[model samples]
Target: MTMSDDIVRMARAWIGTPYQHQASVKGVACDCLGLIRGIWRERHGTEPETPPPYTADWGEGGGQEVLMTAALCHLMPIDRQTPMEPGEVLLFRMRPGAVAKHLGILSAAGQAPRFIHAYNAHGVIDSPLTTPWQSRIAARFHFP
Candidate 1:
């Protein structure tokens, strides 16, 4: 299998993880970024750096691109126009003009792309990449 396949498999393995802020143990608890961090540890050796304390609006309080900055530091940046593939990371803004604070892994690509993410109330789920979600995509990256 390809590296992307391994990443996808690893991400999907966390499908039922309960959403918990600042946690990354698979199947037990994790948030959107936590899910990505868990997969990162499985693929890469160790986390680049521990993240600073963050609220649900991790990027909003001070209008800092906290998540974006960290993503750039750790992930291989993908051009925005690049066609997404399974295992690529997606950074979402949550809403227009807001700091991009949400994240997910592309689980299925091509015509009907889908992503796996842990939402506060929903936990980890594979969600359709609909127009609304598409519109919120601020950036994309892949494992280094």
Candidate 2:
């Protein structure tokens, strides 16, 4: 199977994992970034590095591009203008002028696109990439 397909399959396997900040264990608990880190482990063996402890307002408080910076360091950065495709990692800003902090793995691309993410209080779910959500996308990357 292609690497993108492998990523989608692995990400889907984490479905139902509860959201737990700073945790990356599949099925047990994981936050948005945790979900990405877990997938990285599954696809590429060891993680490049472990993330430091972070609060809910981690990037917001510091105005640091923590998530985007790490992603650029480990993943293959993709042009934001390029059409999003299945298995791509999506970085979201969450709000205007905020650092890109949220992450999700695109599961389907074309029309009615969907992505899987660990939503707080809701666990991991494949959510529709609705217009509102689309507008929040700040960057995209492919697993290296």
Q: What is the TM-score of each candidate against the true structure?
A: 0.97, 0.97
Predictions in order: lDDT: 0.92, 0.92
Model 2 ranges off by over 4 Å: none
lDDT of candidate 2 over 44-92, digit per residue (tens): 7999998888887756887988888888899899987788889999999
- Cα displacement (angstroms), candidate 2, residue 9, comes to 0.3
Candidate 2 weakest ten by summed lDDT: 53-62
| lDDT accuracy of residue 9 in candidate 2 | 98
Candidate 1: tens digits of C-alpha lDDT, residues 1-144: 998999999999999999999889998999998999999899886988888778998858789999999999989999877788999999999888899999999999889999999999899999999989999999999898
Clashing pairs in 2: none
**Model 2 accuracy (lDDT, Cα):** 0.92
Prediction RMSDs, each to the true structure: 0.9, 0.9
Model 1 scores a TM of: 0.97
